[model samples]
Target: MSALLGCGIVLLAGCGSMPVTGDVKAVDASQPGDSQVQVYAVAPREGAAPSEVVDGFLESMTSDDPDFRTTRKYLTEEAARTWKPSEGTTVLAKAPNRNGPSLHDKERRSTETSYRLTGEKVAAVDEESSYQPLAPTDYSQTLHLVRGNGADGKGEWRIDIVPDGLVLGQSDFKRLYRSVNKYYFASGRTNGQSALVADPVYVRNRTDPVTRMDTATQTVRTLLAGPTNWLRPVVDSRFPTGTALRKGVTSLAPDDQNVLKVPLNQKADKAGQGACRMMAAQVLFTLRDLTSARVEQVELESDRGRLCSLGADEAEEFASDNGSGAPDSQYFIDDKGRVLRIPGNTRGSGDPEPVTGPLGTGTVVMSAVGVARDEQHAAAVSANHQNLYVASMVADGELAGPAVTSRAKKAEDRLSRPSWDGRGDLWVADRDPDSRRLLRLANGEGKPQEVTVPSLDGGRIEEVRMSADGVRIALLLSKDGLMTLKIGRIERHGPESAPKVSVEDLRQAAPQLTDVTALSWSGRSRLVVVGKEDGGVQQVRYVQADGSTSSSGVLPGVNQVQAVAAADDELLPLMAETVDDGIVKLSPGDNWQTVLKGGMSLVYPG
Candidate 1:
């Protein structure tokens, strides 16, 4: 017998109680345990009772069984044949509790036995492997079992009807799956140049039960499948519709020279050389950080012949603005209200210098500043926080009149710190109580336009930050003395000459944080959030755009953080403004160190 089966039998033997009579007791197989421990499923013993069968199956779902064949053993022939485990996954707060073996027919003694499976649903992973966090709610499902004859010529109990997909505890789900990013081209290109956007999804950490593919292969299949529903409106997949991996290919690995060769189906052969190259680029980006061995190149092929290939260097054409082409300089407002910059590649407490612009020259005192991704222009909020000014950083020049101004009676309700998107547009929130709105300025010079947020739901916009891809925006909203962080999709409709922009489908990005003080986009699908949980101290942590938490998300504690900033290039140090430390930076594997003795509103180019 295999070691898996051996381990399973040992576990089953330890159950201690036998079910002989018609009285079937509920079995709770999901107990909290070490997440790193591997679990294996045991097949039903001959003449096993219904409770044993159900318990075995539920435990099997949490195991790393390659094809889930052991789990199927607990089901009837019809149920086994029809069950689709790949439909989706439901993650609960803990192992689902088995409620009762209630009689399916109370009037008479029936062969059918039923049990209620209940738990607190915390999240769901759809068929596309996109995870969405759900407000905690009660979850209930039913399992029907029938007595039948086993292949061993003995009476046995098997599941006749079962819930679709897999139900797993949060810890088990985390142990079995990991998040991976699939690359797609942004729908709207700037200056006629395309940039790749990341669409993150979960994949099995080991071999998948449904497809029997390794993690890398499963990720590739998901990429070719297409983007998730939330991101589909703003991104385009390079793979042709119906395109898929060559049938029967289950595993993929880089060659000795770190070249990954992907064989697609016949549909991919229709792509022209340029389109084929783009497809290869998508693959290269998706797999670049997936494997231990660096994938230096990607070659696409069909049964007919080689379609196209892309190398790590050649794929730079599709690189996003956040890519590692150049380091981003960090900026902050000094105690004197002048904008100062730290060189991008500087190490440990580099000297801060004033930028070559009016705001930096003290010509116009500022309280906050946002540098454009190109580092050529900056938007600054007046020291009084009522007016926003945009000026060139490449050369000293007279500052233009306020590009945007607020009329609120109080300084705190006037204007928010400005932010620049990858497309050179500026975004800021007008917190005026009488006229709360999110405003955007085209090219940072045009008149500010109020962007509609249909889902604001009476909440006031406190601050605004734009993603580098221009398809998403992060907002800090205040309502009823509570603050929340939300991520909204930026949808551009109508014609390019006069487009209608609306921030829609706002989802909670940091549901754990009761009061979010500040946040910044840290990577393609991650953010550095500074906030406090209910009745907890202030914390700085990393959170995925999808709102899922990781074991390593929490960072070293920083006191009284007023604002936080991170670069798309994660290697750069993280900067924060604090009440006691002034401007401080935390480099990789190091503690927070003071960068400036007295500074505020620290930021990196968006």
Candidate 2:
């Protein structure tokens, strides 16, 4: 690796008054087109000053060196042996500013010097590879250097005490790592069916420094490791306890036939054929977006031999209805306050037709609507926004009386838009000041049950959108004139006869947006949000469920966006209701075009 650094190198003298008495050059931090363009670590020259050693170590932390052997070269033997880069990662807004090398023990003329590293922390990645974006906060740490004996028999400055794990700038972190989703089954499935839930995590884009594995291999290993801490409460992994990849296996690739063969340890050898196939499904779903070569099949192997195999087509049995299968038809309320639909896969403002229901026939005026994942049932909020009604979309019939009603005097404080989960349950938020609560109806019909949200912290839920997977929910919370988007884990407890649902651990999913107006789940781990920064113009963009932002998140500018809707299938055009343009749709690679000149409240089935 050091030899590779010698080629295409640019060397410059160290600057500043920190006593950097060695060759220092700027690291190539440009965003590359692919993982092939990587920055390798340069070994510390002999007798490097304290500042140079500290700078070199920080630079090496961002490199693609497989094991960080070069990173340890700047540390003393004790520090090197004690350092653990895999413990966690601290991401900063920019490279940390170094100050000092002030003499300690001035009275005794000690050889030790200390440097203060400070920066603004932006996010953190735990050992489990879970990324959590945090409110920017001040970060401070100290690196102590001491004189040590060198192989040349001269005094050398090396880091003696350092912080555990890697500390990287946000730009470098993004360049070195990529987000990937691991699959797990939703727990407590009373029926004979199973659904895979996505657990997104970050991993090295190239080879992992600590694991010494390629991207695909690392992702599979993480899948076997189980779900993340926040998601573990509601999901289960098919992999048995202690199951792991076969020892000494560091790379995984698809054959010419696009089949990936994964060898597992003895723990998996005992799994039955059914369990083995489920395990294969988890791997296939997790790696679907990672590998350069498409994987058509997954064959699981054990110490003894092949245990079982699953083809890509067969893996659909475990697919989650949330974003799987065909594209969903877009729905909205027309100018006449009746529900209308745009057929799925239609392009350029295709003919809009009325749905086959009372809500569509104007039997009862409607303001908002949510269609079930199956497209069999639809829930509509009355024009007054005080009454909630559920009607069949397949069978034409008169709508029954209000299934759920809100008594808030002001229309703005009435019921919110309805959302249906993949489990065939309907969810809505009652914004009534005196009776503020989230309600859910089993099968879109029984008595409305109040879903507990214990972590609201005096804030009110302005809107609610349930992920199709049924294990997560997106909430728009309003407090002090600001609306923030938060993602909460949906936990179901007790027995199937009487289940208790609660939305817990509410965390900011779009902290960068000062005020969020509307949002919808666009993919497994992504959301299309219509919001803006402080004092900035209203705009549309995509946000990961984890709250991290990417350069490509921002969409082409749309004017006066009052509402936004995105389908789980990303191929469908993004629909939104704007003041300037009544309703507009943005296709995959095209600009926004008017869909309906008079429609409002556009949305896709949740």
Candidate 3:
């Protein structure tokens, strides 16, 4: 008898449990050891046939033991010692084909072997405890079994050899796996301010045999792999491309003082001292979240010598380096398309005040507007969407430049909401059917400059928002008949007078979300998302940059949300436009507060 145990990625949703297919009676193969031990202890049935032995072995695979020592009872002595369950686990959509394990007689020998352990592999878990969603595929393994003498000297079936690790159904995987947050930094922040951006991903729980350091190593590897496709451009990693731990090293080794000694390749050694310290900061923040031990410091080493060492306290100095911090006031376009502002965290009923500009007079019907981080500038789109205007935020502030319009023929196909980066550069996406691209108005004025965004695949950008630190952008995109939330990093090259701007590493932030209507960054690495699930009602929720949700369920008080805005506090001074077009505000534990009767579009400074 041969058994194949393997795992793959891509598990389908809603596949709950595997029902028993045939009349194979469920056997209560209990163990003789202390029942209190937290291990899978199923004793082999005496005088049992090969098929019954295979059934008991499969049942033992589901136990949540720290080690598979008890599970080894179903195997021969040699096979028990040779089996390494931690190699990897294969999660299946359904239980294996138990009836297919064929037993073959040996020629004058007390041994028989079985063949064919097969199922649909959906997801996989590695020895490091990381979970990867994979494409659905069929998997088959062969198990070798032997007919041996039992403790009572009777004939018994025992598995002599099997593929590494265990195979489980989707239900077992859901019960065993957990999601955790890994931290990375935003790429472009002015003045060296850095903030932590959480990348949520799946991993094995503490009960798994994987140690804390091994789990930490998996998290580090993911971080080194860079942000997921959607978050890649919006965030930055301290470890440069091609920089990784020394070969043959699986986990980080920390000293008695909790100082993690990380050995990197030559690429890391070339990074200067300042760069090395920032790299250490990323490691410190990530490890702190994974291990209970105080990761007080990180010592980065290269083949040549010590590259740099960073103390935990030094991270605070670069708090905004990731472009996470943003302006706190909530700005919006009112019923008449006039620009207005409201105190972000106010409790009492507050009237929206018009800002200082032609936009406030309603002379120009404004469709959208973006407030700059300094609160001194504003980018406005006309009600027709044909023309874009930029001016000062002060009272009667003069126009910064002449009206700007794209070459597109239709108004709706023209510019999107205008956004401002830390350097005061204005950005807008032109969704013209004939010519789709992102245009920038340097310092919120002057002629339009085209910014290259790779792999957009001709999808129209519905809306774009720049981060406060000026290094990243969040996008609402309509591509291939689906609305997606994507993030990317902004790279500038050449002289300061005529810089070249390109958006690269574009990736989807919410791949499972089918109908994303509105999204805005609430923290350095967090966003308040409003969307609908497949065939579900419209809802609001919070998600990490890596596309994992930190909040439970959707935000309450509305059948559908039209627009959403966020500020960077824990309680999250969240505001949204309801299906009825009324504006509402949400606090951490409070119901939606309808602050205004009617509103157009709203935004918080990037």
Candidate 4:
């Protein structure tokens, strides 16, 4: 790292006299005021005095010695004279410096000190402490710039010296260097500390300590971006650190809201209009918790680097020519873009899906499933890229509930399964998208109620799914937060001895629960609930999908995590999402971590 530090660096000059105004404030012996005034200006380049001004200023900042020292003398005819303190000025760099003049990293670059000048009115001029570096890159020193007896007397402006970070980001860095170059040549580009005040009058004399900043910029740029950097970087290295600097996070909602996701087809087909062309992955419209609609043509192949539309709107007419022999697995979202209701997949814009369902960054995983489009729950069984999967709700690899959508005509025997029970269970309801609707399956010899959700856009019924307990069913409705045959329902409350095994019973049991926000069943007996408290952060809790939590520690860490959702025992064991270059794992053990640097780790959930 020492090799990164340059040797020709000069120290502060022009201390005994004022660098600017040509007249350093004398300790006025016959004064009416209480203090003195001191002013420092920009230094000049090498060779000539004006050129050394900037160097002098820098030297003052870097030097252990005072860049300028003047005595406050008092003597009036030897009879009685007075000298008092007034205003004192100081400068500082606001933020901590991540990089300094030298570092081991080859990519590191050096930056000049930025100064924040301020003043204070005092009774007397006092010596100030030496300046200190805020971090590795910044330095700050405060001094009472003046001491005077005037009506206006107090610390004045608070200024900051802009550091390399802001300076480098500016687009005109190169041009500024050129203007300073001309000033340097006339000064003979000497190698000594001096001053150069830009204040108009001092323009003629190169001897004056202060001058223009244009000279320093040119010299520095030449040394840094020039051939000299090849042999030994003329620029100083940045500060050293245990880790690299980082940027803040941006909301995922904003990312999806602005970016439109569409599916593209390469091969031409004669099946339908715009059949093989990359049609707009139409944004499905939904009334939040109500109905949904759109005209998107998406498929499970979305997981294969494509974004599949779950809405009936987009895929309504997306029929592939049967003569071409399209596979049974290939299907599209209706003309609408919708998905299983996942907790955060609220399509406030009427297109209900994950705030992140576009699918092209390749950051999503097989675990990167699109959530169902519901306010209470989020669900997606497959992706464009994930391998085929079987759900506890989906037995025998067959979707026994809602029939899959197709572009071709339907057959007479569309196929059917017994409702909840072996007999004809019949309590099926596909009304609301955000609520629960039960489909009754008889225990014995009875006909089960059929499940038929209406087309959200007044178009057609698309898809549906049932809860594992076989009590609740989910339907894909239109974008409106309402529905006709609303599936949203409260589980019936039963007696305490024979408690009703439904959500309503459990919710009714809570004396203070008010309402439930996050609801999920842990197997059959336990249920998890997460909701915000009136006065505190959100509460992470659970009871029975059908039972109330009366026990202590129901919600251990309130607000410990944001965006909590139900992750069954099955989804927690492996890596769930890959973001950037890191993997976010959802451990069933109730823990998570990310990979970065040599690896990465997320904030721990205590």
Cα error, residue 540 of model 1, in Å, equals 1.5
For candidate 4, write residues 1-606 as lDDT tens digits: 233223322222333222334422221111111112112222322222221222233333322222122211111111112222111212221111121112223442121122222222111111111111111132333211111222554221111221111111001111111111110000111222111100000011111111121222222222222211111211111111121111121111112233223222222121132321212211121111111222232231222354232434533222111111211011111112222221211111112222223221122222212121111111222233112111221112222222121122222112111112101122323233333233333221233323332323441222222333233333323233321111222232344222233311111212234333333333222334444433445454544322223334254343233222233222322221123434233434454554221111111100
Residue 3 lDDT, candidate 1, scale 0-100: 73
- lDDT tens digits by residue: candidate 2, 70-150: 889888889999999999999887767776766767652345788888888989999999989887899889998988755
lDDT of 4 at 151: 50
lDDT of each: 0.83, 0.84, 0.68, 0.23
**Candidate 1, clashing residue pairs?**
none
The order by descending TM-score is 2, 1, 3, 4
List the candidates' TM-scores in order.
0.93, 0.94, 0.70, 0.21
Root-mean-square deviation per candidate: 3.5, 3.2, 8.1, 29.5
**Count of clashes in candidate 2:** 0
Error of 2 at 167 (Å): 0.8
The digit string of per-residue lDDT tens for model 3 on 1-606 reads 012112211111111122235653222212221122222435665666666566666666755544666567778889988898877778776556554455344563346767566777766666544444444688888777877765666566788978887787655554445456665666545434565566565655444453433566766766666666544555677777888776655666467898998887787866888878888887887777577678888998889979999999887565552222443677888888899888544532456788877777787778888887667777889888888888777667445444577778888688888877656778899888988889887777777889999888767799887765566788898878878787777787776567788988776665556788888777555577888767977778876554544324357746568788775444556888776748788877888777787776777665
Model 3: lowest-lDDT 10 consecutive positions: 1-10
Candidates ranked by lDDT: 2, 1, 3, 4
lDDT of 1 by residue, 236-333 (tens): 98788999999999899999999999999999988999888899999998999888899999999998988888999999788756333567888888
The TM-score between candidate 1 and the true structure equals 0.93
TM-score-wise, the better of 1 and 2 is 2
TM-score of candidate 4 versus the correct structure, residues matched by position: 0.21
Count clashing pairs, candidate 3: 33
